[model samples]
Target: MTSETYPVDATNRVKRRHDRGRYDHATVHALLDAAALCHVAYVVDGQPYCTPTLFWREGTHLYWHGSSASRMLRNQSDGQPACLTVTHLDSLVLARCGFNHSADYRSVMAFGRARLVEEPGETARALTMMVDRFFPGRTATLRPSTGQEIKATAVVVMEIERASAKIRAKGVADDEEDYALPIYAERLPMRTLIGAPEPCPRLAGDVARPENLAAYREGRALEDALADAYRTAYP
Candidate 1:
């Protein structure tokens, strides 16, 4: 079956080279779930602020958390408008001409109004969801959060109103004349690789890492593990 899609408005539409824009829900959510860090922008007291925080995606909603006293969390939890973005730099496009140089990336921009999740129970669950989504099958393996710990943190969930994703995975593109020049041109691919899991010196007995983490090891493909998270069982 075909994937569902989201609407694009003047605010979220990728107009400037619109050909790169995609409104499909799969594309949008994939970009969000592939990365845990998202930069959320909001206006507080007529001044704009963008804060990079760990984020989680579920269905069409995005969630983030921070200290209860954080200004970004405070402002956003009060129903302030927010624009959240996640990006992945896939490669460096080495074009024959400097003017044609561009990076290959996957990115998504989502517009929404943030809502504070006040109920302690729900906030706690959301935190668990974030952990499960990122670390995957690891939440139950560790110690659970305490009541006091939950109370000191704040969580905000944004129901996406409009979202769009842009992806560029092409090889070097240079002007016809520039391509004729004897200049090096190619796409240097990149991925975030992980090193062997280091154990704490004071650690106890045997430690078992998650299976998904194996894909992130050095010489392995990190994208596969990340993409798997984006397609997790939770919606």
Candidate 2:
């Protein structure tokens, strides 16, 4: 059975302002599912690198893909240690003092060993899941990937060993004395809003937008749309 919370070890223990840290699977998974982009940090030949890419979660594992010739993918193909992180900025807090000014955000850092998914079947399935992750039911509307296309794509899966989530979603946290100052203090919420879908100009007029993408309509919050897509795909 999987533990309800990830173990708090030296690798994942929160040191500063530990009250903001969360170890529960619910918190970690929710944050991961709400975002599509992540940074994978790894060391190669004494050099540190962090590559930003699109990723998806499946149970305890995180999956990402890139060109088979990608240096980042090749380096991580041999079960190399990696740290994946995701951050979602929620608001900008303008405090009375410069030191007190901080942004609200939800972030997660997961440690794992990334290895290439070499199996043909598994790689194909992972790719399909990646597409359906944001456009549920749309995969079935498309043609199957050619063998060459599949071979050119490299899929990597990392089983999260330990993870920690830190979130600050509250308002301005100014000092008592600073709060009493005349300086203005407020929280400006931030949002990633979707815009109207622009269909391909060369497409036939008969082609209409798929119903599965209705959740991604204009003015919708990106995080909310992604979360909805995840639930629609998995639920």
C-alpha lDDT of all candidate models, in order: 0.81, 0.91
lDDT for each residue of candidate 2 in 17-94, tens digit (9 for 90 to 100):
899999999999999999999999999999999999999998889999999998889999889999999999999999
What lDDT does candidate 2 reach at residue 136?
89
Question: Against the hidden true structure, what lDDT does model 1 obtain?
Answer: 0.81
Off by over 4 Å in 2: none
TM-scores, one per candidate:
0.90, 0.97
lDDT of 1 by residue, 122-205 (tens): 876887876777666667888887878877888999988889999887778887777678888888888877666676777777
Q: Candidate 1: where is the Cα deviation over 4 Å?
A: 1-3, 210-216, 230-235
Lowest-lDDT window of 10 residues in candidate 2? 174-183
Name the 10 consecutive residues with the lowest summed lDDT in model 1.
Answer: 214-223
Which one is best on TM-score?
2
Candidate 1 has a TM-score of 0.90
